[model samples]
Target: MSPVEPSTAKGAATRARLLDVAARVFAEKGYGAAKFSELISESGLTKGAFYFYFPSKAALARAVIDDQERRWVAEVQQRVLAQATPTQQLADVMPAMLELLAREPGAWSVVRLVRELGADAGLADDVVKPMDAWIALVAGIIRDGQQAREFRADLDADGLATVLVGAFDGIKGLVDSTSPEDREQRLTRYTGILGDMAFAELGILAHPRDL
Candidate 1:
């Protein structure tokens, strides 16, 4: 790829900042509650500038979903699935995800919205289908583990993948209802439990001393 000019880089950075700020605001205040006027104020961008990047609130919301999927796939799913060993895969991805969510609790809101989108007929075609495709890609990684004999043949990899992702949603919900300290503590416990379950289900022997 050709090097980006300094001005281009600056423009890209500004756009990213606006997206991040908009996502946080939308998650904190529902989509309906979020205002483009406020977004411009908080982003320190003129209304024309904001419109240049995102045409409307609906467009911004779509950008938020796309941005979220890109990060999840890049940061969590791709890293784990790239590992040679399934055990290492789980270890790498699980902790990485927890760390990612810790950086932004607003992730919980995004995830919940994804689920809602999946269930709504109005959103099912446009919004939910793309989100489901991303999920299937993540789930496919688990199926690959099963095919490799790294995971139990008897267990349904697709079903397990759904459950695992669903569990994260549940944990996020729990955290949203508690204090930050308690949330981290609970998340640690949840991660441990998930790691144990994966090992047990896969019939993988834990490291000698850890067992």
Candidate 2:
């Protein structure tokens, strides 16, 4: 059976409340460690109300991951990429994601939840994978950069976009493994290293920190 969608203002508010509290809790405590009771208590929703909106922990986790990742992606394009030129936008992408992660608990929650709820989790179909939006954004950036002669015209934009996005996501995990004090600097350095090696042949490379 399909879960009922919120039809009234109060119902919508209740659902939003649950997602907000759930994202924070899941970010602070991994999905396995987060308690359902605490989610209900912190959200100020009764057990009955919680289940009305979300049928199970898996259901709620799916909603939270999808919702938060969509918001994160929109914010990246609207807020982070809005000011930069196409070449600059390409450089800013990974470092800006780390900067957002530092301030946004919701982004971290998506990261944890995405890892926890992979294809075997039974709800993967519902997720708006962050990588898809990022790859599209990078592809657009490459196209524009190529038009401006900022990126090489010899390469296919979408192909280069896929490679760079994969590289960025992988490097991000590496940055996360370092000590807290070293993480940000490492992110900038790693992104720079990626730019140096990857973009040097193809574009006018700028370290993300420099941009």
Candidate 3:
């Protein structure tokens, strides 16, 4: 069953608190390892109160995933794209996402939880939908760039978008495994390289400053 939506302000606060606590708990300890008691304790909510909002741990996990996707699309994807040219928007994608993940514990937790669940849990598709949206957004930008002669007309925007998304995801995985201090530097270098590769493929002359 779906989670209960609280109508009152206090109820809404309580629900949000539960989600925040659950996200941290699940992220720290994988969904299977995370206990209901830990979530309740961290949330500072009683068991009865917790059950009022979330029927089960699985339900809470799903809620966290859904919320993460919404925030990512609204706050990250749409927000960044709104103020930049298509090429600049594409260039900003990875850096913006990496920054968001670094700053937002809940966002980072959602990514960790989704990775832990993998494809066997039947949650992969849901978790990956936001990424699919990102791909579409990037494709649109690439198409715009092509029309403006900022990118190569011979290249397929959709195909290049897929490759870029795959490259970012792969690099992110590697960066996530490194020390926190090194992650930013590693990501910056890796993404810069990817951007250079994209620019080269598109026959665009990238300024050294662009990297």
Candidate 4:
């Protein structure tokens, strides 16, 4: 038989399908328990076909991280951070990130996997590097705000970035414990207080709504 023709759309569809299934599998079984066979079966693809796209289970895990990060940066980060003021950008994006993680718990499984893998030097570098980059991005925005006088000149950008991102990490647990409506209300209150504190540290006067 002659070589099969490849359609770009079909290839894209396959990749999307695989990623979707992989998210579910990773969430259900976790990184250590997740299996390549299950992913292949869920994708309705042969082992060789799956390998052609992802190469290995470790590679697939990396793809999952990258896929989530890209969607997060595009949909959540861009929507908020693209605004005029860095403070406004962070304020808008912070709550949305909380809501997104709360709504899609499966999406946070990669975070759990990364944390679990942190003990391994090789895996830590792979996983932790992206996290550091995200933190660095946030720090950069804070620094910009300070330079513009949108934030206090004395503000500690790196420290503030760490606290801000660290605050959001605990949101998943809180969200899991409450009803969606209650979660929203509680998160609003929580974020409001956090915003107040953050602005206060920089000696900046901010309305609660600004956060």
Candidate 5:
């Protein structure tokens, strides 16, 4: 039989608590090293109760990843991309993401976990699906800017978006390693460079404050 969804408010709270603890555990220990006993201990839930919510470790990990991505897309990407201009949208994406990462270290942990285990576990493509969506979104914004003659039409929007995504991913590890304060500073500097490059590529004069 299929597992039942949490019915009562308390049941839903319990489930959310489990997911929260599980994300931190998986982040700290990685998928292979993370112990179910440790998770149970941290969550203050019995083995049977935990199993009722998540059948296995893999199930919990998948839930964590899905939750993190869904929240990010809804809260950050969708919200920022709703700006008046593609220029503003592009400018806002990195800073908004960095702020999210600062506030939600679990999101960073999920990213690291995916990079570490995704290939061996055959989950790499699945994990990067959200990134692909981001690329598409950025490309669409670039297309809009080009049509408005705000950005250069000669550049390939999709290719530029791919490069932008790759650069962001490459810098993520460095950001993850630093202290919280340092992470913010480094992210600001790196994203500033990104903003400058993007503006230069589009043949637009960036405001001094933007850089």
Candidate 6:
């Protein structure tokens, strides 16, 4: 987790500014290339101001991931939850996230950071595992559906959720090497195939949603 968030308004604004600059920098140059000197200069904050919120690059990186994850859980997941049935709610996960990615630059950085930092970083205790949180969320939704007789009773909700989340995240990586136009086509194809197969097998739907 990040150091305690600022309790003061001015401190909060400064921290947010740093995050905005850092997110872009990290996105352009992966974590290994990002430096505090560049981040502080880009944010127009003094060294002391930057250190006040983040003691190291690793800390700031964790904050970035946590911030983006919180937004997805709040903005994307909550919007999907508004759907009438658990089936609809589960089905909306991919499209809802795609919408966020379309507008949020920070989200793309989080994806790169998750793959990079998780590979090394060696700060397992400090870094928040957003993937784990996602799995728990999906599994909870699956359990609710199962209990309501809306999802298959024979399937293990946790395992099923793990597979869905794993495939969903991995499928996004498949687009990184494609041309911008082809990226959307491939994502839609992969996501639709995954969602359709999973939804049908779970008895959620026989046909795809508008996604």
**Candidate 3: where is the Cα deviation over 4 Å?**
178-181, 207-211
Instruction: Residues 99-151, candidate 6: write the lDDT tens digits.
Output: 78777776677767776787775865544467778888788888888988989
Tens digit per residue, CA lDDT, model 3, 1-211: 6789999999998887788778777766667788877887788777888889997877788788777767776676776577456677777777677777777776656656666655545766666665777688778888988888788888888888999987887776666655667666788788888878887787778642263
Please tell me which predicted candidate would have the highest lDDT against the true structure.
6
The stretch of ten residues in a row with the least summed lDDT in candidate 2 is 119-128
Residues 41-83 of candidate 2: C-alpha lDDT, one tens digit per residue: 8877778877889877777888887677677778778765676
Cα deviation in Å at residue 162, candidate 5? 2.2
Q: Please report the candidate that would top TM-score against the real structure.
A: 6
- Model 5 residue 20 lDDT score: 81
Q: What are the per-model C-alpha RMSD values against the true structure? A: 5.3, 2.7, 2.6, 5.1, 3.0, 2.3
Extract clashing residue pairs from model 1. Answer: none
Query: Lowest lDDT 10-mer window, candidate 5?
Result: 117-126
Query: Candidates' TM-scores?
Result: 0.72, 0.83, 0.83, 0.76, 0.82, 0.89
Output the better candidate (2/6) by lDDT.
Answer: 6
TM-score of 4: 0.76
lDDT of 1 by residue, 1-211 (tens): 1112225878888877877887788667656667779878999988887777877766666667677767776777766767776556765666777777778745654654554454667554655444454456546766666778776778776677667766766666566546656776698787678767766766777831143
lDDT of 4 by residue, 121-193 (tens): 7667776555665577678878988888887787679988888766655454455335556755677678777
Q: Say which prediction, candidate 3 or candidate 5, comes out ahead on TM-score.
A: 3
Q: List pairs with backbone clashes in candidate 3.
A: none
Listed per model in order, the count of residue pairs whose N, CA or C atoms clash below 3 Å is: 0, 0, 0, 0, 0, 0
- Model 5, 104-165: lDDT tens digits are 74666676666665765566666766677668877888898899888898999999999998
* Model 2 bad stretches (over 4 Å): 1-4, 119-121, 125-128, 174-185
User: Where in model 6 is the C-alpha error above 4 Å?
Assistant: 1-4, 124-128, 177-181
After TM-score superposition, what is the CA distance of residue 185 in candidate 6 from its true location, in Å? 3.5
Pairs that clash in candidate 2: none
